[model samples]
Target: MPRRSYDHYCAASRALDVIGDRWSLLVVRELLSGPRRYSDLFADLPGISTDVLATRLKDLERDGILTRHRIGPRATSAYELTVDGAALRPVLDALSAWGTPALGERRPTDAVRAHWLALPLGRAIGEQIDKGTVTVRIGETVFHVVVDGAEITHQDGPAPGPAIDLVLDLATANAVANGTLALADAGPDAQWSS
Candidate 1:
């Protein structure tokens, strides 16, 4: 199907012409962590239908926001952000900041994923530390975030080498993510161990 457009000449409209679809940005969000297999994306996105996921992936690829490549010993195909897609980090950050207040309460129907906290929490951590890895444990979920200068990246498991281990409950984690509480100001709520 031909993609739709706003038919406007403005730059913002032009950008939106490529990404205004419902699931496009969310797909970009998932890929920001790194490459992911189709099954991984499907599993992480709770409510997306397989058909919709496939369509969004194709659309993103067609628009140059992402690319599909082979990786690992089995040469599994994975989707990863292109430079253009990674550029969406600030956009996501802006949205996260703007939407934080809307996240006042977690509805029972809201789907929760620990890795979803990586972006905001990583942003907060990046502000306080210049370099090093921090392994964050929230409940049973474990993920490690690497802060390098102004860039932050994360993966779904613990860091391979030595890292600062920090643990938080969901409430504290949410506060960190929403900017209500800085990671540094998390105080006693943040349990840190070398």
Candidate 2:
């Protein structure tokens, strides 16, 4: 094998090249929610035309960022993140943080983003549930936490009961977590709105 050069084989450099295009990472973002059909991906991405969606999906597949699989006995197909693809969570998180101020605020949907980072909220909440049952959703990730008298039992999936739904843009979420921005008021800069 030829020796890897910093410029040629740098992991970070190669990753940027693959995800440099705006849509590529967005596709990955959708996939983090789990397997999505081609149609669903297109639907989530409002403005991407069919041709563009097809091209981007194929491009991501080619780069091993995604894996396309046939689902159901009827052979419907869906796309999901590969092991390599899952590694992009940090990148996506970063993108979410960076893009929040510019791209997140204008959405008309009432979906609230509860942002938590100061504590292992998953664990903290797990310790607080009465008789051990509650529900929480953080982005695409969901889980059930069992409260065993101040002990935490962590499990994945939507928990049951009223969750303290905290919503914030990715940037706000990051700021709250990193202590750079307060959770009390995190929104897009007014200029981004107009």
Candidate 3:
């Protein structure tokens, strides 16, 4: 089947023509952290069907947003963002900021993943510190974010070396993501380990 397009000459429309499909941008979001195996993407995306995921991967590759390469000792095929795809960071940031307000409360039916909070929380931390690694523990979910000047990168699990470790509950983490409470103002209860 041919990919759909708005057939408009505008830049936004042209850009959307490549990334407007369902699950397309989400795939980009998953790859933003780093390379991921097919199984990893499938597992992280709670509701995506296998067929849909495969097609989106192909589409993104065709659009030059991502590339598939062999990685690790086993040479497992992994998908990673290209330079062009990495350029989508600001786009995702804008969307995350705009959508934060709509995240008023967590619905019981809404699936939650700790790493999903990385982008927003990382951005919040970026505001305070110019550079450093921060390991955030939300309940049992552990993820570490590296802030380098204006760039932020995160991965699941704790930081390998010394870092400013922060332990926060879901509510406080949510408030930080929502911009209602700054990480600096997280009160004394928010544990810190250096």
lDDT of 1 by residue, 32-134 (tens): 8778999999998999999999999999999999999998899888999999998998898778767877887778899988778888898888887899999
TM-score of each: 0.87, 0.55, 0.88
| lDDT of each residue in 1-194, candidate 3, tens digit only | 79898999999999999999999998998888778899999998989999999999999999999999998899888999999999998899889989988888788998777677888999988887899999999988888889999888887789998999989888888888877888889887577789
Clashes within 3 Å, all models in order: 0, 8, 0
Scored by TM-score, the top model is 3
TM-score of 1: 0.87
Residue 78 error, candidate 1, Å: 1.4
- lDDT tens digits, residue span 1-194, model 2: 23223466777777677766658887876676468898878877867788878877877788889999999888988998898987886566565445445533335653333322313333334433445554444456454445567444434455455544443444544454444454334455201110
- Cα lDDT listed for each candidate: 0.88, 0.58, 0.89
Which ranges of candidate 3 are over 4 A from the true structure?
72-75, 187-189
Residue 78 error, candidate 3, Å: 1.1
Q: Judged by lDDT against the true structure, how good is candidate 1?
A: 0.88
Off by over 4 Å in 1: 71-75, 185-189
